[model samples]
Target: MQFSSIVGQGEIKQRLINTVKENRVSHAQLFLGPEGSGSLALAIAYAQYVSCEDKSDHDSCGVCASCRKYQKLVHPDLHFSYPFFAKHKDDTALSFIEQWRDAIIKHPYLSLDIWRGYLDAENKQANINIAECHQIIKKLSFKPFESAYKILILWLPEYLDKTGNALLKIIEEPQPNTLFLLVAQNQDQILNTILSRTQLVKIPCLNDNEVKQYLINEHHQTEHAAAEIAFLSDGNLTEALAMLNNDESSYHDYFLKWLRMCFSNKGLEIVDFVDVLAKLGRENQKNFMRYGISYIRECCMLLAGAGNLVHLPAKELDTAQKMISVMSLPMAAAISELLEKAHYHVERNANPKILFLDVSLQIVKILKFKTIPQGTHYIPN
Candidate 1:
């Protein structure tokens, strides 16, 4: 992939290019950033630039033979390693290279949950196994076939176990013109032995304006819609894209309806609503709860006389204003706690029907009876 194709991270792109320009490209380097921050995309573009036969000062020449191969991720000298669900004892990343290529090419801001959808993964944990480590060692043992450099991009090295030690020697002392790029999220989870052997390339998360503009320019979102999603996404492009796919206005309506039902102590309607929530699928349910939490926090802000800081759309702001009439700051905090707990439980595979029913009752207690949940010590106004 070309650097020009990736979004934002202008400083990071320039820094990576300068490394190639100044001939200071480190052989073993770690590209560390949060998920959805374009770390993997940046690593690929950097590799492409390094392998580009006709690279310009700003980016790679997109029409070159080397650029063409790199763009399709079919270059003989370019290799990839990542966490995979190994069905057989001898399975390596090569077994799923086609799926990997398709997934990455489709969305470079991929998450493990999204990647899981591309595989026949049935509750199986993904890891880079010992066989994959051996395969990596064997792959790096060879010299470059076409290009001047042999490059291997290992994504998510945090999944590497103790067996990762096998690649230590090769990482420390590789053949000339060999580059090892490790793309990872959490620095704390990586093996210190491997961590100490590589140069670090730190990538920051995208800013709100970058995400907003990307949504507007690429996704054709209106300024208000894009601004709301960008604010809610909090620098996660993957989440911003997902939120765009799922209607946030629907979330607002559903959340407001649920709150109104709970405030009125409508048990029958709540049971039906819980049924609707149970069928939303796990991800949607989590997003719904998160939306409720954020909305309630905004209500809290309004109740605390901080309306200037509220960023909700006009209709949602009207609802929040009306909500403040029935819900005080303490009540909003109590409901926020319930929604937050529900979110945590939803992520851990909680039963949505039971979980939502329980949360609804808690909200009823807070909104109707003015009794805060036991753990949260909030006195009603």
Candidate 2:
């Protein structure tokens, strides 16, 4: 991946470029950032820049043999390590590197969930096991194949178990020209020894303005739609990309239809709701659930005299206004809590039809639930 193609984080991009230019590239580097911050993208660009025969101030020359190989993730000297779930004939990560490369090339904004989905895993977890760590040790043992540096990009070191220590010595003191780049979404989960060995680089998440601009330019979206998506995404490019890929504005449409049904006490509309929800892909279903939970919290805040904090769309003002009135303060708070609980349950592979039905019934009840008198207290200790 070219550094120029990455959206936002101009300053960090320049920092990476300068590190290579001055030959100050650390033997071991840890890139810690939240998802959608381009941690993987930055690492790839840095690897390409370091291997580029002719590099520039802004980015690498994309025409070089090394550059072309890096773009396709086929560079012999540039290796990747990420969490992978076992599948047929792909019981180990070393066996699945080709698929991993293809998936990332297909969508660099991917997350662990997306990776698991690509593997068609039912509910298995993704991890970088100790065996994969050994593979890294074996691969980097040789000299750099034509490139100036042998770059090993380990994405999500947190997935490594107790067995990962086999490669600790290698990572601590690799071959003369090898570079180890570890990318993590959660820095706290990294081993202390690993943390101390690598130079830490923090990547900040994208702001709304940055996200909006990138969406407009990359997706050719209208101004108003882009602004609304940016606000709703809350600085997560993965979430924003998933939202745009749906083409149906599934959450927005469901949010509007669901809220209207709730406020108008239209329980008869449950069948249509179920039908529409059943059609969504797993990612979009989860996205809608997350959005609903957040939106409900916003509604509660609005009822509690925090309307200014709500990030409602310009077009959603009318619906928001109506929802605030129809949903009593106590009901709003209760519904928010219920949705939050439901969200957690959904994330754990709960049956969606049953969960949605139960959640829907609770919402129907909350729509008519009466509030207690002010200053009321429940005794339970």
Cα lDDT of candidate 1 equals 0.90
TM-score of 1: 0.90
Q: Ten consecutive residues with minimal summed lDDT in candidate 1?
A: 372-381
Candidate 1, residue 119: Cα displacement in angstroms equals 1.3
Q: Which pairs of residues collide in model 2?
A: none
Cα lDDT for residue 201, candidate 2? 94
- Candidate 1 residue 252 C-alpha distance from true site, Å: 1.3
**What would the per-residue lDDT of candidate 1 be over residues 10-91, giving only the tens digit for each residue?**
9999999999999999999999999789999999999999988899999999889999998889999999999999989999
Q: Supply the global lDDT for candidate 2.
A: 0.79
lDDT of 2 by residue, 169-231 (tens): 998888989999999998888888788899999999999999999999989999877877787
User: For residue 111, what is the lDDT in candidate 1?
Assistant: 80
User: Estimated TM-score per prediction?
Assistant: 0.90, 0.86
Best-fitting candidate, scored by TM-score: 1
Candidate 1 residues lying further than 4 Å off, grouped into runs, are 120-123, 264-269, 337-351, 369-381
